[model samples]
Target: MKRIILVAGATGNLGNKICKELIKRDADVKAIVRATTSLEKKETLTKMGVEVIEINLSNIDEVEAACLGVDCVISALAGLGDVVLDLQKSVLDGALKAGVPRFIPSDFCTNYNALVPGENRNFDLRRQFKTYLDGTAIKASSIFNGAFADILKYNTPILNLKDKSIGYWGEKADWKLDFTTMEDTAAFTADVALDQNAPRDLQIASFQISPNMIWTDVNTATGQEFRMQQLSNLEDFAQFIKKQRADHPAGENELYAKWQQAQYMYSMFSTQHARLDNLRYKDLDWTTSLEYIKSFVK
Candidate 1:
């Protein structure tokens, strides 16, 4: 029997990649899109041979109908509390109603299990949904890929490409932060969605590299010989971001506020994958940090 996989948030960045990967793997793919999604986007999905189902997500009957016969539902839905907590619950309820056996939540970031509570709001939302998910009978798995490796393109404290410098916090210059390219993550997810016996959690990194290591990779890839800088210790950086978050109440409503981004930066240096499951799926050709940097540097 062909694996039937249903995906929510099919039009977004990571979500779209996952759909294509699923189709490439020959799964019977279904995408749950908002009724208001543009015609062009729907056509794009249809072109890929995905069954595009437009429904009112709040309507359990409609959602249940879309979920019927689905072997697994993969939610790449992104948002604050409204979508993550409330809308995901609605989706889960419909999956339960339809008797779907597996669910993959949109937890494509650091090993949040290793982070302290009340430190990262975005992670906290995922953590809250996880609590609700654990109480259910459906098999759930969260894939933690650390920060997306794409962040390297953006000039962050860690890898300031424009500045020709790499940096770190406290003594974490050697910490191996997990990073997986979206393409890599999507390919792995496609494999997991078809897996009937996947575990509660699976972690992988296309390549794990420390700040010290990033400097070397950058040099090898670009020959730029980027310099290094120490930002600050984790404790002081955490306190600074806490103050920034409290001082700016308006940012709470936005998805990636400045403090939230800083919180994410803190998380990268703070926690890493205790172990990796990269070899679970044998077909993936992982991208290395050197190759990733080489892509844009030249």
Candidate 2:
């Protein structure tokens, strides 16, 4: 029998990709979308063989009805406090009420648990949800995919493509930063949703390459030998971001503020995937850092 899977946030980037991956594996997929969601998004999901339903999201009964017979509930909803906390709780409540045994929350990012409370604002929200989730009767799995490999193309501080320079905050030039491509993450997530015995925490990375190791790939890809430069000590950089956050008070309302982005950079150098669960799904084709870097240039 095909695995019946229900997904929230089906119209979103990662959610949509996860749904597609489920469909690729021949799982019977259903999606709960907001009534205000675009017709194009609903039609797109419909075309992909998903049973798309419009739910209030706040209505536990409606969400419970939606969760009735699905084997697993995967939430790929991406947002700040309101969506991640309140809306996700509603989904969790409905799933438990409906006796859905397995759940995969939208904890698809760095190992936020490894960082301190105030280090990353967004991660704090997930940490808050986790406390509640742990107390529940339902089984849940949190997939920590580290940084998305797609960020490499954005020319972040470490991978500055324009200046041909790799900068580090401190002695982190050789730190292996974990990165998983969306495709890989989605693929692994789809498999985990189908696995009834998936562990509570699963960490996976397509590649873990440091700035020192990445520069060679950048040089080969662009035919330019990039220089490694230390921007400042990590402690000093942390203080700089603290001041930036204090200066821009309005950024507290914004999801990806400048300081928040800096916090993410600080996190990349500070903590890494202590172990990767990439091999859990033996068939997954992990994307290498060199291939990803070359893709950026191409």
Candidate 3:
């Protein structure tokens, strides 16, 4: 039987790549996407002859109807809305209702335990969703890759030179967080989702990386002296937000709220870096290197 795999958030960068990878392996895919997603992405998938359907993540009934007869579900759901948690619930509900056997939750970042309590609001909601999954019949797993290499899309100073500098948060020099390129993560995900013996909590990645080491790589690659700005004091972010809101009163409201929530959650990064070893998936032939990551910087 040709396995029917449904990918939520399929129009997303990672999700789109995953769908293509699965198709490359001869799997049938149904891309569950938002109606508001870009037409370019929709048309590209449509031209590929893949099935694309409109889905509102918040609507569990609609999601269940979409999951009918699907064997597996892979979600890359992302946003700053309450649907972060709700989407997981809806997926779980729909998967169970549809009698789907396996689920890959939207946890392609680092380990959940690495985030200290109250740090990273996303982790808190993710933890809640994980707990919900634990009580369900559908087998579930969360893939962790430390940080998405594509984060440069947001002009995050940590991975780019927009401000002529790079700042990494964490403790001592030896702390290495796991890293998986978006491309490799997508490929590994497709491999695991199709593999008959693949287990839950599969850690697939190129390797673990330390900010200190990454700093060295940045200097070597860019040939520019990079300065490291460490946020040691948790309160520093609070003051930063206060000043930012005071300066841009017009569109600053929503951004300020997001910044405040992130500040509450990511402060744990200042002290410790949670390192994950994803070498278990080496047999799957899905590993990229720091050298490979350099190509995506542009």
Clashing pairs in 3: 109-145, 119-265, 120-265
In TM-score terms, candidate 2 sits at 0.98
Model 3: per-residue Cα lDDT over 47-160, one tens digit each: 776799888867888889989998889988775335557776787788789889889888776566555555455666677788788888887767766666555334564555
RMSD of 2: 0.9
Summarize candidate 1's per-residue lDDT along 1-298 as a digit string, tens digits. Answer: 8899999989998999999999998999999888899999999999999999999887778889999999999999999999999988889889999999999998888878888999999999999999999999999989988889899889988888778888899988898888999999999999999988899999999999999888888788767788888888888999999999999999999999999999999998888888999999998999998889788775
Q: Which regions of candidate 1 fall more than 4 Å away from where they truly are?
A: none
TM-score of every model versus the real structure: 0.98, 0.98, 0.79
lDDT (CA) per prediction = 0.91, 0.91, 0.68
lDDT over C-alpha atoms for residue 211 of model 3 = 56
- Which structure is stronger by TM-score: 1 or 3? 1
Residue-level lDDT for 13 in candidate 3: 84
Candidate 3 off by > 4 Å:
34-39, 55-59, 152-164, 168-171, 228-289, 296-298
Point out the worst 10-residue segment of candidate 3 by lDDT. Answer: 264-273
Compute the lDDT of residue 54 as modeled in candidate 1.
95
> Clashing pairs in model 2?
none
